[model samples]
Target: MLLILSNKKQLLLQAKSLLLSASFQQLSRSSELTFTCHKISAIFKQSRPALFNNLYLAMSTQPAKDHTEGHKIPFLLDDHTVTTVRESKILVILRGLPGSGKSTLAKEIEQKYKENSRLFSADEYNIKPAIRSSDGGEYAKLDEDLNTCCERREANLIVLDDTHHDRERLEELFDFANKYHFIVVILEPKTPWRLDCGQLKDRNHWKLSLEELKNLRPALEKEIIPLYFGWFVTKRDEDALRKTSQDFLEQLGNFKPFKKRLQAYGYEDKHKLDLLKYFGKTPNILHCTTKYCDYGKVTGSEEYAQQEAVKKGYSKAYTLHLTALFVTPRTAGARVELTEEQLSLWPLDAEKEVMPKDAFPRGSRAHITLGTATEVQDVQTGIDLLEFIKLQQAGGEREDMGEICGGRIHYYENGMWMLTLPRKIELKTIFSGYYGKAGVSAPQRGGKKVLLPTCQVM
Candidate 1:
């Protein structure tokens, strides 16, 4: 007999002899309870009526467990009923080290079901050179493949084969299961399989070593924790935003305040501002941060992550309204106005971060960081937003910097500027739970090149 506690669900694995020999008297006397009495009673009632009668007799001789502390037995669940329950459409999410038999188990399950199941493997897509060319583009392709499978699922089981070390990534599949009303069954091996095995090594497959995997787990989890969630700009809108940002940066150079500040810093090149280098590279993950959890590192983050409403809304798309663009010496970002529906997803205490309690409105710091200053981390963008909001609240006289690129520039103190767009840009975006490593190179296959545009907008 064996007992396992996982995700609050208990599993009882037993031999037939143990099941047959188990009596009410023996069950009542045993200190180790594998299952609640009601569960045992229900199972016995269906499988062995005689045993259940004896169990009822034994229950009459002793006090029953308090109802509040025990599960209510709904019905006598027979083996057939149990089998029927298990036969429902299931999403089996396989998670483990690269060589730890995930794909092997997936294949076995697929074969067992044959025509009643299908397996979706990320590795299958990874091996194709044409699909593996763009950085961060594989996620979109994987989503497309998974969505396609979910839409046309005529099977009892769908096996998702991937190295789902990140919880947010796993949540993406979970969201699909929740939408399609499929039960999620997560399978993870206890021990990691070696990635450097002879056969695996010979295949030239991408994998992480045991040590590297161990080191990466925390970082991946931290990133996956939705430190901040926001709507990613659509492909069409992203192009316009990029152009608008570049033109704004060039226009900033013409301003007297900016010129004086640059000259003060001993910069004499007036012909060309080279603002692109000053603002640094554009962010790989583009979205406004509604809340920053700091990888569950901040207080109350754990509670926030576990909120039922938060989980229910995970990965749902939203339309964010861009109200204005803000700039400081340290950052360039967009101010977003959250709607009523969006506000429901935003935590009440999100704005309490790095500020005096109740100082700013709930969603005042909602902004997308276009670029960050050299040596500044992305999180600093939120701080810059808070600073801008605070400055506005202090009621400074706005220096009308006039119209530039169809937007009005109003200068705030301390080299801070707000360019309120003539019209709010309504952007269509999907909620990506986690952003992977900032700029990872796409995997190469077979020494072949995939032709891509040099000036791609998205």
Candidate 2:
């Protein structure tokens, strides 16, 4: 009986050990699955954020809710939605250094857009990947291919995969986009090690050295070249200015001398001439333009953007005192009296370029264009300002048209009028650059869309 009891105890111990082993294996398997899930989640989060968000909501303990309403996912839009909802043409320009995962991102974008997307890669054209291209032959061919793609309108979305470090190259792409009426979206890789030269050296397909990678870093590190640089007026100030400018226009319309001048300039029905429509609202941020970079296509633009003064002043706020309101047949603007600090960011040759013969001080041509005449471009505003300065310097007869809007009005020949204010109009503004967009629209303010005129400097 004692032997049987001992055997039973041993059997019980063996059963308990087997049960523990089974439990341990099960736990190990669960942990492995959890880790894999996490890895997959991370990848999806990066590649397909919208889809991942939906999946996460579905898998949550709470009830799944559709945050997107009825609109389909960007990648999975139905035929009806594609035809009606989306922009007809889009050019996605992937910009980054080699090994920065630009190509990877391009592939993902192409995959997301599916059959509607077509990718044009410089590598496919046999152009070596570098900050600067040694040969123009392959690049020219690549441009031609892209041009053809744009001409054909073959795809809803066209992806260009390349370093795109050169501003000139980017300008060419912008030109293609403009010609094709395609919305241009520049995308840089979100990889943490994108700018890490050492990592890039190892990861790059070309096996470029650390030195080569470093050489490519400077161009990417520099500030993005803008279509133009200037002081952006605050919304509040802009509204006030708009009202003041409208009032001034009304005052000018009623003034007989101004009417006579308009009549002399072929505006036969001077009384009927709508000055507001004659000088349409410019669709741009109301600011005094400092330099028109033209997206680095202009000579010395890149250098001007890279200046120490420009770098320091960028996005910084400063006060501009508007001393006068001036109007020409081409443009209407308020002259900005730049402080010494503001003058530091002003291009030395800005005024000289427009009036090379005169030795006007820096910032002399600084003016915030309120409006431009029909068919006249914004650049004409600065030229008009210079012309006014030249007339002022030449001691041209000033017909004192008396005070309008609490300012002394002086007519300076050939439909050029100036209003010198009793007190300077002070404006708060931030120094910034304007990159071209699909439309001339400002951020929504007070639940209403604020539209700005397109900066048609180019």
Top candidate when judged by lDDT against the true structure: 2
Off by over 4 Å in 2: 1-194, 199-223, 437-458
Looking at model 2, the pairs that clash are: 282-453, 283-452, 283-453, 283-454, 284-452, 284-453
Q: Evaluate model 1: give its lDDT.
A: 0.57
Tens digit of per-residue lDDT, candidate 2, span 2-44: 7645644554444334333443224234554445446546555
**Number of backbone collisions per candidate:** 1, 6
Candidate 2 yields a Cα-based lDDT of 0.68
lDDT of 1 by residue, 55-132 (tens): 557545432221111111110123422233234555667665555455656665576557668788878777321112
lDDT of each: 0.57, 0.68
TM-score of each: 0.50, 0.53
Checking candidate 1 for backbone clashes, the offending pairs are: 227-293
